[model samples]
Target: MGMPSHLGLDDFPDDVADEFPSDVKLALFRRARAGAALRLYRRRGWNDHAVRFQYDRAAAELAIALDRWEHRETNPTLF
Candidate 1:
């Protein structure tokens, strides 16, 4: 499926959708899109070191967001 401009909570798995707030979901979606954009930029030969670093950071942030959401969903104490 193609990337969406905005990700709704409904886009998440039912468990996740029920657990995460809208802001967290939006952040996860934005970071994912940013990372994807950076990847495309690098692929197009726009491989400046700064761009690469930003891409890496974005990717890391996206992973962290997902992890955080998962943790919140799985652990009642975290929610």
Candidate 2:
């Protein structure tokens, strides 16, 4: 079996999670911020459309970074 559809930084293989690519770092930062925002939104009882949109955007960014990283690892010559 391969990695799951969703993965946290710790779920990544090896030290790649620690010394990640710049894009991964950015995505992780955004994901963390979005997560924090979600918590704040919930605390304020603002479970609206915007909150969902932010969540989706953050998830997409992280997924993209992971895909890119996986591709780079598999086909190093192409990168």
Candidate 3:
């Protein structure tokens, strides 16, 4: 479903989430520092507006994942 050279930040593999342990997944759920955010996009070879968008989206995903884990832990739901 993707090309080798097109592996951008948003282009992270779908299976990546499935591979990590829940604890490791929770680690990616933290808020990344600004420098880390920039470094992440740069490492992914992003620049310009695309870089900003990818950084914002990645942060949002992390926030959402953290919230999901929080809720799951409190409610003890099957996830």
Candidate 4:
């Protein structure tokens, strides 16, 4: 599936994109899209808040991936 034009790969910071693998980058983008969707749903007063859970989970996953990339970048010998 293609990302929305506003959320395309070019939107990512160069440093972050260069450090992350393709899969990780895609995951981050997906998480961002989920967060945006969650915001829209909340703004429109949709009753179901279950999407917030999904958005939270995606945020957590993205955070973990970013942490791993940062750690690896700083500790090259450990890998």
Q: Pairing residues by index, what is the TM-score of model 1?
A: 0.49
- Deviation in angstroms for 70 in model 2? 0.5
Candidate-wise lDDT, in order: 0.59, 0.75, 0.54, 0.67
Of the candidates numbered 3 and 4, which has the greater lDDT value? 4
- Descending-lDDT candidate ranking: 2, 4, 1, 3
Per-residue lDDT of 8 in model 2 = 65
* Runs with alpha carbons beyond 4 Å of true place in candidate 1: 1-44
Please, what is the TM-score per model?
0.49, 0.75, 0.44, 0.65
For candidate 4, write residues 1-79 as lDDT tens digits: 2222323356555564665566567767878888888989988989647888888787777766666766666789843
Runs in model 4 with CA error above 4 Å?
1-19
Error of 2 at 2 (Å): 11
* Predicted candidate 2 versus true structure: per-residue lDDT over 4-75, tens digit per residue: 344465655765556677888888788878878888988889865687689779989889888998898888
**Best lDDT among the predictions, by candidate number:** 2
Q: Model 1 clash pairs?
A: none
lDDT of 1: 0.59
Better of 1 and 3 by TM-score: 1
Pairs with steric clashes in candidate 3: none
lDDT of 1 by residue, 7-79 (tens): 3344545565445566556666666667677778878888657766765666566566666756666787843
The clash number for model 3 is 0
